[model samples]
Target: MKTTIEKFAGDTEGVSYELTVFRFKGTSKTAPSAYIQAALHAGELPGVVAIHALMPKLRAAEAEGRILGDITIVPAANPVGRAQYVFGELEGRFHLGTRTNFNRDFPLLDRPDKAALPPPPRNATVDVHLKRLLVGLSVGHDIVLDLHCDDEGVPYLYVPAQLWPAMQDCAAAMGVEAVILWDGESGAAFEEAAIHPWLQLPAEKAPLEGRVVTTVEFRGLADVYDRYARTDAEGIYRLLATRGVIGDAKAARPRKFSGVAAPIDRVELISMPRAGAILFHVEPGRSVRKGARLATIVHTPGEPDGSIDILAPQAGYVLTRVSKRSGRAGDDIIKLIGEARSARPKAGALED
Candidate 1:
């Protein structure tokens, strides 16, 4: 296994973004290759552990000559977001000045205009150019696994529906039963852009023909040295083996909630509209009826405090809730999973 760090774009007096590569060579060109990246949002640390554990296995596979194809691992993919800090707290999710989510704004090529290309020839200009860049770096193989984790909860995989069965086989090897399908509506998430959206394009537009490209999401913020982290790492290695990049995957015991799942149809981000002290009336994961008491917001500045009771606007399952006691206006208090409904102009405002 040979590791090299190359500067792709930004590197200045104080800022640098380097692409870290771990290459493991296979004897035949027929073998499949794998790519893995982590820490796009630096605060999500499980993926960092997942990639770190994958490295030693890659090295072992290389030494044993068990490698079936080339493998590339990038443990830290975003240096800019990873280095951001605010008031001693690591603020790695957004760009400091712009406040833009670093994971958003992925670039994509426009579909070719019919006039530009005749029937016999397809418009492969844009994606071809884009693929040329990624392929040139790892010219020998096929497959890319962009790993990630949420801020607070369970593990899941975002597999593009187009690449089903093939990628499904790959996912199943990790005993991953649930997949959060990216049906083209999860706006601008890096994995959605790189893996799922590419799968949606027509054959002429897609760059990968038969390769498996998908992402794995481990459970949310928790102990780095916890058993869950170790379990997640092992699952990744098993996935590598099933892809023919390594030897047999270690046996793993599936968790309680191990199974395929669909992404929530709607995300009702409940937040307070006024500065107040929060008091919860319901726990997370509870199904609440419309108009039921959900929580209470109180203005507790003086001895005699005034409070406003908050109620659920619709029936839904509470996916998450804020634990903080105090909240400012517009701070997210909870996120409810709800039934599909038409888009409203001020949809989010209703929740707040």
Candidate 2:
């Protein structure tokens, strides 16, 4: 239950981020050491609520010496984003001035050559820097959970496909109903950029060699500071318990969703040819057929109202749709998902 506040290098507003660590003082090391970070995207708030609710229980676990190894939790991980707003509307999703999503751009560092280290006595900030230091800190852990929430949609699990069935089982144990196995290349995402090098086998190897990492989406945006977010917190707590970070066996166990990994084959993003006010005809997590009427744009007078129909593309499940009713041209529509369909679009189709 100890906490430390450190100022990030680029922070100018005097806002400090707290990093809390919980562990039993006198206990044997546990199998899984983990980290939890929330509020990376300020507008997406559920993770904040989830962490607050889980903290008291974590403290109790620490007092009872049930906590095994280190578990770090950073609830308000992005103070800058949290503070960004305009006329009561959240401007936190994108950078205020540049309009860029902060979560999309983190620094990437490649592995350093063994011979490159000058006896570990580098005096320069560039050599012994925060990026290198954080990388070193993360390499020792079993798992890193980056807590996130969608702007509007059902909760889903996002893990590097490299982790496979173990991660799938873990997600189900945490009560995550839908899991998306993402194989696309990630850029500058906080969780991915921080640990991707360690997960790689070599320069361009297919298999990862180190610990498993995942970014979990709990639900939609705007509920982070509230009580309902506890669902995700409890789910993560169960996951930690199952991994042996906490001593309670009952807390560690949970019911499984049959064929947890099989449904992952169905997740797909249906893009719009042109975007306008997104009229959603189908809600999230529903089953839809191919060529079903998904949404109809409200046509303005004197203009051809472009009608958008979301075909399930393949017969499968629907996970989530665009949260905001209004959309600019070229935005993505609901992500129509179904199990493992070869008809899924290739990478180039998604590229601009």
Candidate 3:
């Protein structure tokens, strides 16, 4: 195991970000290589803590000569976002300067090789440069995991449609509650950028069966706990072993995915009709019948019919809800996986 510091100039003078990369060398060249990054949004710490717990296991494997393939880890992927504190809370999802999502708009190359990436523009923002650096570090790996978390939700994964069923083992190994398969475009998100190059080539050049790439939503934002971290770590370790990155005989086999798996279009992005405080009736991992009351918005506080009930669009599985109690008009409040495709489905990401 060796540590490498990746530094880049900030947008302004005397400001810069230092990204730490940890590498684990393998003895065998035939084994698959993996790259795991956490907290691309910076404040999402569940994956970071999981990686912390996983380091010891990797070290043990390294000491015992069990590491068969090269592995790279970046526990805290965004130092810039980590430093962005507005008033009191951490604003890690979008960059302050560019106001762009940290995980979106990544450079999509035509090939899996990093050399195909062109140099960043002279007038590009710091976030743009950061995206390029992340791509350069993560491209061409057999496995790439970008760790993120929803506002409030059960553990889930956003896997490209091309990798479904093949990636079912990954979902099972990670012990997530659901899997959302997406195709076409996701505003060129990191997951899309990671797999786009491979999709351009023939299967003979880049086999889909052996490749693993995903955006793992490890429960919710406030779910950072010691036990959960350890459990998530064990899950990731099991995946590495299952992929032959590490030779671990004791790791339990991944079970069949027993959770809900559906296309991204199956998600019902329920929005608030009016601005008000939200009162949720269902939590994550719950199933709802058609027209079931999911939440209520107190739009006008003192009137008898002040609150408006937000019902289920259809019979579906409740996947997530917003962390905040209040919302403006048309704010996306919850994600429910419906039995059928959404009537009004949009392309790209679920949200901006």
lDDT leader: 3
Report the Cα lDDT for candidate 2.
0.61
Q: Which ten residues in a row have the lowest lDDT in candidate 2?
A: 112-121
* Candidate 1 structure, TM-score to reference: 0.70
Give lDDT tens digits, candidate 2, residues 247-347.
78888765565533433435567766565566778887677777677776643534665465545566666666767787666577666666566366444
Select the stronger candidate by lDDT from 1 and 3: 3
The residue-by-residue lDDT of candidate 1 on 1-352, one tens digit each, is: 7778765432235544555766777755766677777766667778888767667766776778777777777777666666678888887766665565655544332321213222222433222222223333432235666666654444556666566645655666555535644455344455444553344457775555456666666655553654665676677777667666665544322223335444434555677867889888876557788778878888765546577777776776665565477899888777555544313212211221
Judge candidate 3 against the unseen true structure and give its global Cα lDDT, from 0 to 1.
0.93
Better of 2 and 3 by lDDT: 3
- Please give each candidate's TM-score: 0.70, 0.79, 0.98
Supply the global lDDT for candidate 1.
Answer: 0.59
List runs of model 1 lying over 4 Å from the truth: 8-17, 109-142, 164-178, 185-187, 196-212, 249-260, 263-267, 279-325, 338-352
Model 2 TM-score is 0.79
Runs of candidate 2 with Cα error greater than 4 angstroms are 9-26, 96-100, 109-139, 201-210, 223-227, 259-266, 301-308, 340-352
Q: For model 1, name the residue pairs that clash.
A: 177-259, 177-260, 178-259, 178-260
Give the candidate number with the greatest TM-score. Answer: 3
